[model samples]
Structure formats: C-alpha cells, structure tokens
Target: DTSRPTDLQRLIDGIIDDLIALEAPISGFFEDVDQLKRLRHSEANDYYQQVYGLEQRRQAYLSRLRTQFVTRLGIRTEQLMRENEQRRESIRRTTYGRVEDCIQWVRSRLEKLSAMEFVEDLEQLEGMFEEHKVDNHEIQDFRQNVDESIARQ
Candidate 1:
C-alpha cells in the first residue's frame, strides 16, 4: 500500500542519472512539456521549438561524450606503449646486457680464452637474442661482428 501505482511512479531515473553525471539541464522535457501539451494545438510551433532544443542539447552531449572517449583511448594507448618499452629495456638488461658483457670480456682476453668457452659463449649469446625476439640493426651488426671474430681466430 505504501508503493504508488505504476502509472504514478517516476520512470526518469536514467535521464536524471545522465543529468547528474554530465551536469546537464533536463532541457525542459519533463516539467515543462506536460504544461506545453495542455495548450491548444494552435501553438504547435512551441512544441516543435521545444523538441528542436532538446535535439540540439542531445547532439552536443553526444559530441562531448565522443571527444572524452577518444581522449581516454589515446592516453591508454600511450601508456601501454610506454609499458612495453620499459619491459623491453628490462629484458635487454637481464639478457642482452649480461651476454654483451661476457662477450666483451672474452674479446679482451681472446688470447687466453679456450676455444670451447668462446664457442659456448657465442652460441649462448645467439640463443639469448633469438629467445628475446631481438631484431634491430645494432644487434644484427653485433652478431655479424661475433661471427667475424670467430672466423678470424
């Protein structure tokens, strides 16, 4: 008995929520329209004007929503790219950096390096490159340099 009849109940919660979220006016659709409808049909121009106003407001809100969405998407894409670059650097430090240091040490003492150790180091470095999907001009040049060093020895 406490509940109002369905016909008397308010059903504009969705519109109210949007108005609150977007800080937009109702565009005189609810409170003013009923009074407008009560007027004679001779004033049909008033009804059309109100409808047009509402349409304009809706379109403006849609434009704002789309702009905000695109801006957020762009920010997220840039963030993801930065995260990927960071991970690549971390991998390089752990994999390529360590291997490069070992290779450099071996090169510095090539005269004392055992043939087996040199071959093992070369293979390990190559494996590290392949495993990490490294593909760049610098890395390619380094690989070529390693091959040439081994050939010369």
Candidate 2:
C-alpha cells in the first residue's frame, strides 16, 4: 500500500510538469502576437505621417506657383497700361502740331489775299444766292468740308 501511494504521487507530479511546459509555449505565442500587433500599428502610423507630409508640401508648391502667376500678370498689365498711355500722348501731340500748322496756313493765305479780292469773292457768293433764299444743302456741304478738314488735322 505504501508503494501504491508513492506511484500515485509520482504520476500526479509528472502531469503537473507537462501542463507547465505547455503553458510556457502558449504564453510565449500570445506575447509574440502582441509584439507583431504593436509593430504593425507603428508601421501604419509612420506611413500615414509620410503621406501627410507629402500632401503639405504639394499644397505649398501650388500656393507658390499661384503667387508667381499673379505677380507676372500684374506686371504685364502695368506694362500694357503704360504703353497705351504713351500712344495716347503721342497722338495728342501729333494732333496738336497738325492744328497749329493748319492755323498758320490759314493766316498766311488771309495775309496774301488783297482786300479787293476778298470783296470780289463775297460778291460772287451773293450773286449765286437765289432772291434771298439760300440753299441749305450747299451750306451743309461747306460745313461738312470744314469739319472734315479739322478732323483730318
């Protein structure tokens, strides 16, 4: 009976040792899985941060390009405005010079004409009129000619 008890105690101790051995490997497997999960989470975080950085850089580059384009457009517009003003001033000067020349030519022609010739021209103009009824069309044509000459100047 003493031998039987010793055999039973030895069998129970062996079973306990087997259970501890199995638990050691199982616990190690759980630890390995936890470590893998942490690593995967860290990798995902790093990838997201990289993508965010790239997006920020892209936005900055586009903003700079937009600013450069706007600045160039403004400069071009100012140059065009200056050229337009210069052209207008040149046209004004040319028109002024032409009007001055026309005035001088009229004064010279009036100075060259004798008083008798001027009176004779006036008499001829009166003779062409019909009994105090002047032709409105002829007057309009003369006015249009004067207007055209001034415009040409």
Winning model by TM-score: 2
lDDT of 2 at 21: 45
Error of 1 at 113 (Å): 99
**Shift of residue 103 alpha carbon in model 2, Å:** 0.4
Q: Work out the TM-score per prediction.
A: 0.24, 0.29
Stretches off by above 4 angstroms in model 1 are: 1-24, 27-30, 41-44, 72-153
Model 2, runs deviating above 4 Å: 1-76, 114-153
- Model 1 residue 88 distance off true place after TM-score fit, in angstroms: 42
lDDT of 1 by residue, 58-110 (tens): 54554443345434333234643563466446435545544675487557545
What's the C-alpha lDDT at position 79 in model 1?
42
Clashing pairs for predicted structure model 1, backbone only: none
Kindly give the number of clashing pairs for every candidate.
0, 0
